[model samples]
Each structure stands twice: as structure tokens, then as C-alpha cells.
Target: MTKKVLYRIATLLGLIAILFVSTASTWYIYQGDTPEELL
Candidate 1:
């Protein structure tokens, strides 16, 4: 594959990873009805 193709794939994968992580983080922060341990 070309370097440009590889870089695009890498960037897409990174973005997907970031989206996945942020979604999970938001769910974790907002999913509960009680006080968190850190609060």
C-alpha cells in the first residue's frame, strides 16, 4: 500500500478510537444516579 493510504488508515483508526473512548467516558460519567467515589 502507499504511504498516504497507510497514513489515512492510521488517522481514521485513531479517530475511531478517540470517538469510542470519549463515548465510553461520557457514559461512565453520566450513567449513574448516585454519587461517585471521587466526589
Candidate 2:
């Protein structure tokens, strides 16, 4: 049971990390295209 819980937590963390990276990259690219608007 404990192992299952840990696995779930790890999976959640991995998904969150992936989403964070994707969002960061997308924002970075968008800012590159529209530097004036972001500022």
C-alpha cells in the first residue's frame, strides 16, 4: 500500500514537472515573438 502511494505521488510529480516545463518553454517562445507585449 505504501509503495502504491509513493508511485502515485511520483507519477503526479513527474506530470507536474512536465507540464511546468512545457508551459515555461511555450511562454518563453511566445515572449520571444512578442517582447513588447510581455513588458
Candidate 3:
């Protein structure tokens, strides 16, 4: 694959990972856990 395509894929994966982490953190917060614990 071209470098440009690979870079785009990497960026997309990074964004998805951030989204997942934020969602998980929010869920944890609602479960009575601090977000710092997740970090």
C-alpha cells in the first residue's frame, strides 16, 4: 500500500482508539470509578 494510504489508516485507527477510551472512561465514571484510575 502507498505511504499516504497507510498514514490515513493509522490516523483513523488512532481516532477510533481515542473514541473507545473516552467512552470507556465515561462508563467507568458512571460506575463510581475515577477516570484517573483508567489512566
* Count of backbone collisions in candidate 3: 0
Residue 6 shift from truth in candidate 2, angstroms: 0.2
Report backbone clashes per prediction: 0, 0, 0
Candidate lDDT (C-alpha), each:
0.93, 0.91, 0.90
Model 2 lDDT tens row, 1-39: 999999999999999999999999998888745657667
User: Candidate 1, after superposition: displacement of residue 33 in Å?
Assistant: 4.1
- TM-score-sorted candidate list, best first: 1, 2, 3
How much is the lDDT of residue 10 in candidate 3? 97
Q: Could you give the candidate ranking by lDDT, starting with the highest?
A: 1, 2, 3
Instruction: Candidate 1: give the clashing pairs.
Output: none
- Alpha-carbon deviation at 28 in model 2, angstroms: 0.2
Q: Model 3: residues >4 Å from true position, as ranges?
A: 33-39
**lDDT, candidate 1, 1-33, per-residue tens:** 699999999999999999999999999989877
lDDT tens per residue, model 3, 1-39: 699999999999999999999999889778874578667
Give the per-residue Cα lDDT of candidate 2 at 10.
Answer: 100
Off by over 4 Å in 1: 33-39
Q: Which residue pairs show backbone clashes in model 3? A: none
